[model samples]
Target: MSWIKTRLKSFGYAFNGLWTLFRTETHAQIHLLALVVVTVAGLITGLERWEWLAIILTIALVVAAEGMNTALEALSDALHPGHHPLVGKAKDVAAGAVLFCAIAALAVALIVFLPHWL
Candidate 1:
């Protein structure tokens, strides 16, 4: 394939993965709802450019963390259909990473929005 075609195919795969994540993952759906709420709040509050950048980056961080966690869980399940302690540990770690990212995202949101509300 040409370089452009290869890049396009890669993007298509990424989009398909994103669709699967949002369609089948409850956590992803919740994140989507949160994203919508944050977007509306930002618009209503009229965020400055830097505030919008922080919000956008934080949202991306959360989504990427969630996606990585889902991917790890799916792979673990497929590789070891039976319960295994190490696999469980790995999955837990991945989930913990997502939780950490989520907490950080919440902090960023509060820092960006609290002043506006106040």
Candidate 2:
């Protein structure tokens, strides 16, 4: 119980970072909106058991990656506090990771949902 409490306390910073990301990040908002739509469509379309698992897993992975990326960018900016090419490139790379996850999620959706729609 004590260990768990200490672990949770350490997560306060992460939670704060996540809240900041949700409030300030436009792309994060967009991803969340898409997550809602995809979840609704999957449920309404009666996806197969495996499809449900894939859809849920993909959403989790993408969102988790986005959150981590947001944290990384924020930390980097705080540390650098000035315009540096390396910092800029690092941020861009983090953003690109989110984009890759979004694209992969789209592919997963097409694979799982296309037969029904087509």
Candidate 3:
């Protein structure tokens, strides 16, 4: 394949994975809901450009973390179909990474939105 075609094909694969994530993962669906809410709130509040940038970046971070966690969990489960303590621990660690990103996203939301509300 030509370089451009290969790049486009890769994008297609990435989008397919994202579709699977949203379709099969409840957590990803929740994140999508949160994204819609945050977007509406941002529009309603007339967030400044910098505030929008922060919100956008935070949302991306959280979503990326969740995606990574999902990938890790799926890989672990596939590799070790039987219950394993180490696999459980790896999955837990991946989940914790997602949690930390979520908390940071919350902090960013508060910093960017609290003043506007108050």
Candidate 4:
């Protein structure tokens, strides 16, 4: 029972963190909108099971990367509290990670949907 309770509490905290990201982050909101659009497109095109799986995984990867970037930025800011070259570099690297994931996801989307569109 105690173990189960601990796991549940961890889940609760995870959900709360997700809520914080969506509530406070503009990038998260944009990603969510893009997710909705992609889901709608996938449904409308009748994506195959494997295609659906790929799309879902790609979306999750991008969002997770964005979340990680946000977390890093927050931590960097909290630790430095002011301009610091190292902190700036850390934040830039985090943002770049998000960008890399977004680009990969976009490429996957194009590969998956271009045929349907054409």
Candidate 5:
């Protein structure tokens, strides 16, 4: 009972957070859309197992980063409650991480999709 309780305490918070985010975060919904598309594309394209793994992992990474960015922005807004340059910069930086991951995913997509289509 003690061990199970500890494990749940450690991980359960994340699930609750994800559920809340799914309900409220528009970006989370966008990620869900990208996730479905990327997964279907992988299956249709017949990527090798490793390529499929890479594509799936990359998409998860993108969504995970985006989710974290959304969380930070929410928390930041709560903490600041006013427009400040530093707060704005922090949000921008968090968003930039999402952008970087998205660009990387697009590159992976090009590698995966271009040869088949062209």
Candidate 6:
């Protein structure tokens, strides 16, 4: 019972984090909108199991990367509070990571959908 309670508490904390991200991050809202659009497209196109798996993985990867970028930006802002060269570099790197993930996800979506579209 204690172990189950601990796992549930962990899930609650994760949910709280996700809620905070969506509530506070404009980029998260955009990602969520993209997610909805992708999901609808996948359904309408009748994606195969493998295509669905790829799309799901890509979505998860992009979202996770964005979450990490957000966390890093927040921490960097708090620690520096002003424009410091190292902090700026770190923030840029974090943003770049999100961009890379977004681009990769876009590529995956195109590959998965092109056949259905054509």
Best by lDDT: 1
lDDT tens digits by residue: candidate 2, 1-118: 9999999988997788778777898878887888899989988899989999999999988888898788888799899989999999989898898889999999999999999899
RMSD of each: 0.9, 2.0, 0.9, 0.7, 1.5, 0.9
Q: Which run of 10 residues does model 3 get worst, by summed lDDT?
A: 97-106
lDDT of 4 by residue, 4-110 (tens): 99999999999999999999999999999999999999999999999999999999999899999999988887889999998899889989989999999999999
Error of model 4, residue 80, in angstroms? 0.7
lDDT of 5 by residue, 1-118 (tens): 9999999997889888878877788877877787788788777877788788778888878878988898889889999999999999999999999999988988988888788778
Note the clash tally of each candidate: 0, 0, 0, 0, 0, 0
Weakest lDDT window of 10 consecutive positions for candidate 2: 13-22
- lDDT of model 3, residue 7: 98
Model 4 quality (TM-score): 0.97
User: Between the candidate structures 1 and 3, which one is better when assessed by lDDT?
Assistant: 1
lDDT agreement with native, every candidate: 0.95, 0.89, 0.94, 0.94, 0.85, 0.93
Error of 1 at 45 (Å): 0.2
Q: Give the TM-score of candidate 6.
A: 0.95
lDDT over C-alpha atoms for residue 61 of model 1? 93
C-alpha TM-score for every candidate: 0.97, 0.85, 0.96, 0.97, 0.88, 0.95
For candidate 5, which ten residues in a row score worst on lDDT? 26-35
- lDDT (tens digit, per residue) of candidate 1 on 1-118: 6999999999999999999999999999999999999999999999999999999999999999999999999999999999999999999999999999999999999999999999
Model 2 misplaced stretches (Cα beyond 4 Å):
7-17
Model 6 Cα displacement at 67 (Å)? 0.4
Question: Which residue pairs in candidate 4 collide?
Answer: none
Q: How many collisions between residues are there in candidate 5?
A: 0
